[model samples]
Every structure is written in structure tokens, then in C-alpha cells.
Target: MERTTDPVDETPLTAEEYEAVHAAVAAAAGSRSRSLNSLFADWKDVVEDVEEGYSLCAPEFDDDLACRDALGRAWPLLPPRVRAIRRPELDELDGRFRAATVPWPGRPEEPHQWWRYRIPLVVEAEAGLPRPGGWPLGWEVLPFPKPAGVRVVEWGRP
Candidate 1:
């Protein structure tokens, strides 16, 4: 008798399975942005010591332009202790301008390139400030994979 491995019961995935696969692909592609931020944060404490604040201008998609503008508008509203740090020299330095093209599908081809600038601010001592939680739309938490591609991950906090 010939022995053969049970054909692994290969079957077409159902609708739910298809959706899951789709989500996983999208998450993988979007994870890069979050990964970059996490890497930067790891070194943030040291950077913060050198300057009161630091900022990064990460190019944003056109859809996110509103969020970027919102941040810019909010900057001036911050207290004096919280200053918007601008380094014209560092502007356009990261080269994160390209629109997302893979892993996630159906995204606009003409997504505007917006900049993500981060500035450090002192959390005011005053007790009366809106609680820090829940960012606006377009802000999402996604898993970041290891650089070596040796592992997989699930939805993660940003």
C-alpha cells in the first residue's frame, strides 16, 4: 500500500477568512509607520535631554492632511511651556513622502504628502486639562513586526 500524507484538507477560505486575510495584509503594510515611531521613541529620552522638545516631519497621505492641520492649529493653543519646535533644516529630511502602495489595497493614488512633526511638551501640572486618550480618525494602532521578519504579531498599541 502506498502511504501518502493526508492532503492537508486544503479548502477555500470562507468569507470571514478572506476578510481576516485582507485585514492582516493591510496591517502589515501600515505597520511600518508605527514601527518607525516606536524606534524613534526608544531614543526619545536621550534626545529630550538635549532639547526641550524634538519634532519629526513625516510625510502624510492627503486624507490625513486635515489631521496634520489640526495638530498645527493646536500647537499655538498650547501653553508657553509647550513650544512648537521647527527645524527648517530637518523638514523634508525623512523622505517619508511616498504614498502607501502595498499590503493595503484601494487607497488613493494621490494621497497628499503631509508632514508629521512631533514636539515635546511638559504635561502641565494644573489639574484641569482634557484627559489624554482617544486620538481622532486616521489614527490607529497596528502591530509592528520584528526587523528580521522572524516573527508575527497582532494588533498593537501605538
Candidate 2:
């Protein structure tokens, strides 16, 4: 259901759609064996309005170096124009990494129009610390306990 000029057309998801989303989330959460990449690849189709890809960053680092290192690795995978937002409230001990893809000027028809899909990473921060061999430039070694939680929100024009 695409949104037109009318605000009423952009109403919240129907009960059936919500149910599907809930089911998908539950499935993702339960699949502890899958990696983060695999989880996103599997469920991206189930969730709607996810044009701007999601991200995962290390928030519970001893220093900014670790945080920046994680962000640098995850940045390339994110959709173009996406930027990181520091979320301190999500985890007071380690904070959280949030990346958002903002619509470019004049591209109102893109997915950034009225709604956005959010997928949260359920990471085991302590387990993913830099190894003695050195931290790789990706999340392959990161301990992802389960697939990310998903949600949709109406975030009108920036």
C-alpha cells in the first residue's frame, strides 16, 4: 500500500499485516543460530518499507576507538546517505549504534517519504570484543544472539 498525497492513505498497518510482522519478528528472535547478515537477508522480504538498509555497531566499547572501528566496518554496508545516530538510552552501559538513511533533496518518491523500517541488532557486546589476532573490518566475529527486532514508523519529511 503506497502512500499518496492524502494523509489518510498512509494509515497504520492492518491487523493482518501487523500479525505477519509480529510473526516474522518472533521467528527472527527465535533463530539464534543465524548470523546477522543471514538473518537480515532472510527476513528483509517479510518486512515492508525497508529501503534504507539497517546497521549494527559496537556500543559497549572501552573507548571510542572500538565504537568507531565498528561503525567504519558497518558504514559501507548501509544504504547511501545513511548516517549514524548515537542512542544513549537504549543501553546505558554501552549505549547503542543507530544508522538512518535520509532521503536526498528532490527524491520525495523514494522510501523516505512517509515511513521507515527499523531493525534492531541484538548483539552480545562482550563476546564480540577485538580478538588477539585483531578485529576484522566486519561483523563476522560479532556475537549476535538473535535476529534483530523490526518495526515501522511514520517519520515524515526530514
Q: Using Cα atoms with residue i matched to residue i, what is each candidate's TM-score against the true structure?
A: 0.19, 0.20
What is the per-residue lDDT of model 2 for residues 36-76, given as tens digits with 9 covering 90 to 100?
33333333322221234222332322222332233334434
lDDT, candidate 1, 22-60, per-residue tens: 343234334323322232232233234213311221122
> Residue 66's C-alpha lDDT in candidate 2?
30
Model 1 stretches astray by more than 4 angstroms? 1-60, 84-158
Question: Ten consecutive residues with minimal summed lDDT in candidate 2?
Answer: 81-90
Model 2, position 118: C-alpha lDDT score: 22
Against the true structure, candidate 2 reaches a TM-score of: 0.20
For lDDT, the strongest prediction is 2
